[model samples]
Target: MLQTMIMTIVAIPLVLGMAAALGRSRLPAPAFALLLPLFAAVVSIGIEGMPAFPPVRAAHKFPYVLAAGGFVFALVAWRMRVVAPALAAIGAAIAIGLPAWWMGANILAGNSVKATTVAILAVLAIVGAFVAAARKAETPDGAHLLPQAIFATSLASALVAITGGYMGMAMFNGGLAALAGGYLLVSYVSHIRGNAQALALGGVGAFAFAWVAFMGLVATALLAPKASMAGLIAVGLTLPAAPLAAIVANRLTHFPAALRPLINGLIAAVPALAGILIAGLQFAG
Candidate 1:
């Protein structure tokens, strides 16, 4: 418990810092952001010993991970733009996914029904986050949808992993929280550079919703056994609420002047209603 608490504490602040930096800074946030993960990777390599670079090793399939991300930054530099989040995000996706595939596939393969389902969900979350980050990085003009999606999907996967009896739930959950918080902090950095108010609000909303998702997971764990099917249903519906929050944030907070309140309302309302009904079922059961 003490260790978990410490991790949570460290993760939250770090994530918040990263998120804040990403959103507001006119300077090279990606390069700055790269420092932390790069340092981490270096530390990991020191401890693990330098395995050949991914491209050189047969075991490492996503060899171009860094290259793809590096390319984005290079593109930006050539054009004389600030290093973008899209570059780091693309790099991060490759970094996380390749390792996860190599490591996680085995665990996922030897599972019972519930465990297998949870494993699939977790893998999807990891992959989805990668995709979302890449998408957001690639298209900065629009409201950043991918980061939020990544956060949401990651949260859901963590919840499912914890509730479904995965052994590494504590670490997974802690990581999810950190990643989500980081996404928000990064947006704050964007906000500092004169980003729209809605964008910042959207960042905050997504951050808050991530915690709410975490709480739902806790609730599911404690209450689920008593109302298995209903709890599952509640959790199932709640799983997508993060994406809805993102959509609403994007539409309401960051969309063009014309589409603001109307689309946001629709996006927010539907999931809320769905969550409410599902919660009712959990209670009823």
Candidate 2:
């Protein structure tokens, strides 16, 4: 477990930092929103090793889903100047639904209705998250607020997975949270340093992979028999927490600009913490 924490959470500085550095220098667009975290996620998955191709098991398909999400989101953002959340949701439905059906073929054959319902809910949840994340810089109080919210989402997801009896899923979410935290760290520093890159990542500029990966992760987990679906939904409340926090913080007028991101994250953590506690209670017996 310590090793898992090290690889997933602690490695953020080294893994994600290096990825961000590369994006700044080598990449033409220099956007870390999708590629950087995706890179971190892929590296973190190394803890479990590479997932098998043409995954026969539904659980084996996360890596592929993450990659596809990364590509689809990146492409959509690049091609279209602006994308409606509904359109993105539909695209997500296709991108994620196909794989859910494809990889869970054998297991979900008889549970088609269940799988479809879960897929719908997953898409809805993803849209909610996208819409919320879209408001990242709406107030300009917290540039890192978006990624910090993402960290909360993933960390809360890890808690849900833990109570659901899915250790692998827990670690996966933990890694994602860690990677997002890395982004948050860098964003904080850049914001303080007054770098151009600070505001670049401010909105959903490079969030192609996160939404895609989110749909895949939630839908896949919800489909699992042992999954704590209710708990996960409760955890989903964290989706809007960041933006809402930002709004409230924005109203404060005197709130320190430099501390805005941290404030938003701390506020969002409330719901996530509540979700964790609720999930823990569910398994208390």
Candidate 3:
């Protein structure tokens, strides 16, 4: 466990430094976002060995596929511009639901009419939340929303992994958290200099991608019969917490603009802590 934790800790700064450099490169926003998952994959493989692929069976390989697909869909949505939300909804449903289906989740397999209905409704809910979060982050007033959301999701993912006994996944998520943290730090610096628009705009893709991919991960947890339900619920709560933080922070006329991201980070941390606590209990048991 100590070794695992050390590996996760070390991977974050490495990935963060690399991602920060990429963000500084002035690559098109969508292009930059598209590359995040690849970095995540490299980190995942570096720590966990190559994720089982192809004939290795979907059960073992789905994580890698889901992670990659989520980012790809975000790239597609960014390229679609005005149609991004609709496209993202479709992409998210497929990216998230398909993995559940592969995992033999009754909710996604359409085993019965009622099950199928519930599955569709659940997928729609996730899609709605995802699109809403992405759209909210895109707004000028909510510019910091996406980075905070990504941070929250990554944090929750790491917690979930610990509870679920997926040390590799924990490391992967820790790397993601570091990347998001680094991005947020860079973004805050840019904001201070009045040069944040480029990073913020480019972040739309990364944010959207992280949103969907994390949703898929949550679904993966929810479907696992032995997974910690408390942990999953905690993760779900963090999803909207991102946009909610933005909304609340926006209304705080008395708060300094420079400190808004700090406020956002605090808001995002609430659910993340809850998830860690619940998951830790399960781990302890």
Candidate 4:
């Protein structure tokens, strides 16, 4: 776990630095966003001594599945533009649902019915989030969606660590948050230099949403049976909070444009706080 943490911390900066360099080199925004998180996931798995590809058990196979699915969804969003979220929902449903079904069959054979129910709920949640994110991505000032998604996922991931005692997963989430935050910083630099229009691309929003939803589903699956259902739902709620908050924030016509991000950040933090409270209760019990 300590090794995982160290590797994640190191890899985030390295990947972000490379991403920033690439951004400065006039790389397209969609490619930049898609590649960075994918690279981070690969680096994370490598550092954890996990195989990139293996005919392994479903429990051990989800990270790779999510990574690939996220990339494909991101690409679809980049190319299709109009129906990106719908496409992403289909991909995410398959990627997340298949592994969940496998886990249901193999690990929770005694509770296969309940497992199937959970898998269905998970797919629904992910598809819902994708739709919400897709709607937000269509707005003119949707750049803030990416960072908000990243931050919310980071918080939920940390909560999962608290609930499940999975330090490696926590570190992986931290690395993704760091990468997303760093990318925003780099994008700001690009915007300042007049190289780009906004801090994020619509395609990146899809990628970020997919990544968060995938991780949330994975965390819930791993932790829910052991933890309180309320706590698990609290954590799951964080996945869509950011995009939803962004929608509200965008509608705040009274607020200054420059202060919108800060307001959105606060709104996003609400679900995180709720998650932390639930986690603390679970730990205390």
Candidate 5:
């Protein structure tokens, strides 16, 4: 009951924050969007009333670590050109080391081996994301990655929600899902500036459809034990399928000239097909 209420309260801010961030050209938009998730996290902490975070297990609250890792990577990347190779090397090392330390800590604290592994991988992803961002920031078009970053972070939050639900961290999953969905919508829409408002509106509409469909599946998993079966179906069918369809459609419509059919075909085919196949198996069974 509390979880549902909290999710309801958090949803409004999450959606609005995402919309605002997506519309803005400056960094503050994303900054503000970022806060919505943090706010959710804070609310979750209060709800759970867990005394002190358990020794941070992997596949758990690792996104927090990833956020921090990205920060550290960006800091190191700022000095990349000066010590080019060395900076890259150090960044790579820390990327590897942070997970190692995280896992070691989890193990020492008696976390499950699987959880420890997931935690490390999450940290690595966050670090890699940062390192990429840092390296790109040095280039003339580094700003382009912002959209991708928003996308990546949104995806990460979705994954967090799924994993958190599996771990019985119900509030965490709901809050994270709400926040991630909101931000992605805002960032993606905002990136489509100076275009026809109609087209932008259409794009947002499509994204909202996808977002709602996906989160509905996730929400079910968190909120209902029996609904896990339905959640599985939705995830397998909608999650990858929706995104793949949207990406392909966008490319065909707006980026027809820029679209590399063969390349994009392969890019879209692999995952979309895999997602369908996996879903088919689940349905079959």
Candidate 6:
């Protein structure tokens, strides 16, 4: 168990931090970020040995989504010098929505109400993620909101997934949260302080990684034998926390400029912590 934590939690963030630093360097930025999500995916595999070759379980299929999603978004990032809203929206929908369908289709098949409800919520999540990533504050202080959002969401999801009846996915989400934190820390130096392109976190590749991985975790968790929809929904409240943070932070005009990002991060964490608590209560009940 300790070994698993070292590999899945500790080592992953260290590797991701290095990767984010290198990706932000002068050497063809987008290429270095192409496999960023795969870093977390490998740790996930470490938590639970490689899925069957044929992948008989719906959850096993997530590896392919992570790989394909990261690569596709990397290409999009490589080509898109600027994140065109329409194109980002389309990419996010395909990357996030398609994977959700792939994992949840069978799981949600028996209940039309669940299927429709999840479908609508999934759409909202995709749109919210896109808008959050696209939003810009007058200062670079807001540059980290998307990463903060991703980190908070993944952390809350990890706690919720365990109680929601998916320990493997929970471990995987824990690794994911680590990766986001690493990305944020390293990219802060490269992008925020140095004023480089957001190749590591805020860019198209990073946002794609964040949304794809988080949604994939949720979709795959839904396939768990005893998955709880309420827990999943509770953790999902963190999905919109980033933009909400922005809105809330804007209302407080007196904070120091340098402290804005941290303040926004704390705001996002509120919903995340609340989600975890709500999910925990649901699980206990």
Query: What's the lDDT for all of these models?
Result: 0.38, 0.59, 0.58, 0.56, 0.38, 0.64
Weakest ten-residue segment in model 3 by summed lDDT: 198-207
State the lDDT of candidate 1 residue by residue for 163-220, as single tens digits.
4444244243345445555655555444455664424322222322322333323323
Predicted structure 1: lDDT? 0.38
Model 4 worst lDDT window (10 residues): 223-232
Q: Tell me the tens digit of each residue's lDDT in model 3 across 93-144.
A: 7755665555555444544542443354346446655556457345554555
lDDT by residue for model 5 (1-285), tens: 766665553665366446544543443323432333344434444444433356344433443543444344334334332334344435444554454455344342454533333333334333433344244223212222223323332333334334334433344444544554465455444334433221122111222222222332333232322222322333323233323344444444445322322233334334324433443454345
Residue 20 shift from truth in candidate 4, angstroms: 6.6
lDDT by residue (144-165, candidate 6, tens digit) is 5666777787887778777767
Residue pairs in steric clash, candidate 2?
Answer: none
Off by over 4 Å in 3: 1-9, 12-25, 52-71, 74-79, 103-125, 128-138, 196-204, 212-216, 219-226, 281-285
Candidate 6 segments whose C-alpha is farther than 4 A from its true place: 27-29, 111-117, 133-139, 187-201, 225-228, 250-260
* Each prediction's TM-score versus the true structure: 0.42, 0.79, 0.74, 0.74, 0.44, 0.82
Deviation from native of the Cα of residue 59 in model 1, angstroms: 17
Q: Each model's RMSD to truth, in Å?
A: 10.1, 3.8, 4.6, 4.2, 9.6, 3.3
Residue 107, model 4, lDDT: 53
Cα error, residue 270 of model 6, in Å, equals 2.6
Error of 2 at 104 (Å): 3.5
Off by over 4 Å in 4: 1-4, 10-14, 17-25, 28-30, 33-37, 52-60, 74-79, 84-88, 102-105, 108-130, 133-137, 141-143, 188-197, 216-220, 223-228, 251-258
Candidate 2 lDDT tens digits, 1-285? 777568655584345744564354345442433575466447546656777777655556666766665665556556665556666556656765676666666655676555554655565555764664455235555434556666777778777777777777776677677666666666667767776345234324445534633553464365445555555655656654556665665666576657666676777677677767877887885
Give the residue spans of candidate 2 off by over 4 A. Answer: 1-5, 12-14, 21-37, 105-120, 129-137, 195-206, 216-220, 223-225, 240-242
What ranking emerges by lDDT with the best candidate at the front? 6, 2, 3, 4, 1, 5
C-alpha positional error of residue 202 in candidate 6 after TM-score superposition, expressed in Å: 2.9
The TM-score obtained by model 2 is 0.79
Residue 120 CA displacement from its true place in model 5, Å: 9.5
